[model samples]
Target: MASDPNTAPHLFDRALLRARMDRARRAGPVAFLLDRVVEDMADRLQAVTRGFSDVAEIGSPGELLPWPLADRFASITRVDLDESETLPLEPESLDLALSALALQFVNDLPGVLTQIRRALRPDGLLLAAMVGGDTLTELRQSFAAAEAECEGGVSPRVAPFADLRDIGGLLQRAGLALPVTDVDRVVVRYDSAFALMADLRRMGATNILIERRRIPTRRATMLRMAQIYAERFADPDGRIRATFDIIWLSGWAPHDSQPKPLRPGSAKSSLEAAVKRAPK
Candidate 1:
């Protein structure tokens, strides 16, 4: 069950999460998924926005994009949470900021977005993608059932994900302009739930809740979760499926140049008149 929105404490252990990422960076196939999202972000940036002199890519994997497209920026700074501080970005120093699959783990996401807004110059853009929505539903459900049956209780096994509307609200609350949010759901087929869990481990996406049980999960619970997952989510071919919802968000630092919604009731035509005039 989810915690109260008003009273939920920061549950993630940042130190442990960083350690998981360091280990996952060694061998993570999930990087391919992020690579695709990066390509999409790059295309959108190049196609819609002006060329920026200073750009930063937070959480860049081992290699920077090796292509002319990346050279369009006069300078690009790659930052990783493990390598440097994730907060206190120099105020108004960046013209463009990119984050791929990194913001979800933040304990204070709204504050972080506000910081990003502060770090961006007028009209500077923040384009990012994070795991959200229904991500890991099968695993979460399976874990809950297995733990409830075996241990008489359930612990947090998956991180809670925000939906598109909530993220849009956050962007607006951060004083961003032209905020937009969308989602893409991707399902991957696996031989069993164990394979999916292994991939999550390799991706450094495992549970790292501070309130998580200190003792290791029981072996019986693990096996039961696997069985429940297969029984509930397997296809006709007997291969289980895992769901990942990627939420993409874009917002610009508040600037007068950006388009604004027209004032309420400013339209020349009345809504009732327009409806009556329409073909019936």
Candidate 2:
């Protein structure tokens, strides 16, 4: 059963995340990841034969729809990250919904997707991209190893990411039809783990887990983490690798025109008969 949005466990510090985002915006966000996903989303949108007149972009740092996409929609609404749990739009109000590099921080992902599903019109579409799978795996492992050896234990350093199958299941659970999910893994090279950490701050993607260590990481532990990262994940040139897995999800509001699955025992021919008829 899906948990109530109001009572969902607080896995993230949303207030802190908001402040971090504000600071990153003031300093100019590191938008390479966002740009890449938006471009890919635009390409996907272009491939669809139909057109969307009304659209909403939820939880994006800034305007993401490019020129042609913006032109396609008669009206476009941009919702901030804080409002994702309870959307302002009415039921059946939107023909399309888009989100880029958001939703991962959401405490109740199923609740948010349910809200989005409610807002979409019959046959309306939802397209989103979020960090998931093995994103920042190297850093996460290095931190764990360093903390285990130096600090004697590991606290939550990086946020947990959902796998593609898990996301697909959420879409289905939210009453969406024909749900699809895929991953695009990106490997970034950095001179050191510190460089990667700096970029994460610039992207407003630093640690905000509710269980994160409130105190600063020890300097010795930090140094050891960097060293472990270099020793394990470094390339031929000595630069370390950081991974970001962008998981894409799409689903449509149920409609009669949409394809339906075959019912159990509905097949007219038996598998044995079909195999017998095949060429040797």
Number of the predicted model whose lDDT against the real structure is largest: 2
Whole-model Cα lDDT of every candidate shown, in order: 0.82, 0.92
**Cα deviation of 215 in candidate 2 (Å)?**
0.5
The window of 10 residues in a row where model 2 has the poorest summed lDDT is 80-89
Q: Give the TM-score of candidate 2.
A: 0.97
Clashing pairs in 2: none
Error of 2 at 152 (Å): 0.6
Kindly report which residue pairs in candidate 1 clash with one another. Answer: none
Model 1's lDDT to the true fold? 0.82
Residue 224 CA error for candidate 2 (Å)? Answer: 0.4
Per-residue lDDT tens digits for candidate 1, residues 21-61, read 77887774467667677677767776874767788777644
